[model samples]
Target: MPKVFGFAGYSGVGKTTLIEQLIPRLIHSGVRVSVIKHAHHDFDIDRPGKDSYRHREAGAHEVLITANRRWVLMHELNGEPEPSLEAQIQRLSPCDLVIVEGFKRSDIPKIEIWREANGKPMLYPEDKNIVAVACDVEIDCDGLPWLPLNNPDRIAQFILNTFVHD
Candidate 1:
């Protein structure tokens, strides 16, 4: 399995945007990256009119949709308990790293994304898994390293350095 790192933050703090910026940088650095994002609400990648959607709505437990360039696999829990992070990791093809978004309380090493304007309390105070803070403004990280949120290159390098040592 790939090494796992995570991004944890409250809603609308740019967790998704930071991950978007970081993925390409990591890929450029030659680290194969996969992402597992936890959604707190019901969500779907397929629509009602699509064939894959029809298959799923008809009681299929899994449906894989493919085109020439890419493919995606959608699985229905169908009342099964949600799997743990490790179980989800096992489903991904081997890569150098897996950048998980959400699962804020998971034990994996994570960078807590923060924005001062968001008016949210810092998570590092409670989440020991948070290894660093990525924020729009400098703040006390309680001795954990403070990372500049705007510099994807620096953040990407930190991730690389941390990954190698771990």
Candidate 2:
């Protein structure tokens, strides 16, 4: 099975930024990576007036747009409960690793991204699945792995060393 890792943090703590930086490094290193990001608010990938958008607006349960280079499958819940993380992961194509952002309550191993200026309490103390922390300032983590938030290359290397194996 492909290895799975996650990043969890309160809003504006640079979780997305870290992931953005890590992707290129991982790709450059020849590691195939996939990401699953959870959005709390409603988001739309298809814009209004587009065929796919019209199809979905017309009550299509799912709409798939295909092209030579890429394809996207949009599933409409229509009040259905969101699928579990495991179910979502099963939908992805094979890859070297799956990096999940958010889904903090899930049991998968995660690295918590923290920023003191975010004015939010740390999540690692409460979430046992968190295996490491990337932060802007030094923290008293009781020996948990600490990664510098400013250095994406180091962070990428750490992730590769910890999760990816030849």
> In order, what lDDT does every prediction score?
0.91, 0.91
Candidate 2 lDDT by residue in tens digits, 48-137: 999999999999999988999999999999999999999999999999999999898889989999998898899888888888899999
What pairs collide in candidate 1? Answer: none
Candidate 1, residues 1-166, lDDT tens digits: the string is 6889899999999999988998998898889999999999988878889899899999999898889999999999999999999999999998999999999999999999999999989999998889999999988888999999998889999998997436
Runs in model 1 lying further than 4 Å from the true structure: none
Model 2 residue 78 CA deviation (Å) reads: 2.1
Q: Tell me how many clashing residue pairs each candidate has.
A: 0, 0
- Candidate 1 differs from the real structure by a C-alpha RMSD in angstroms, to one decimal, of 1.1
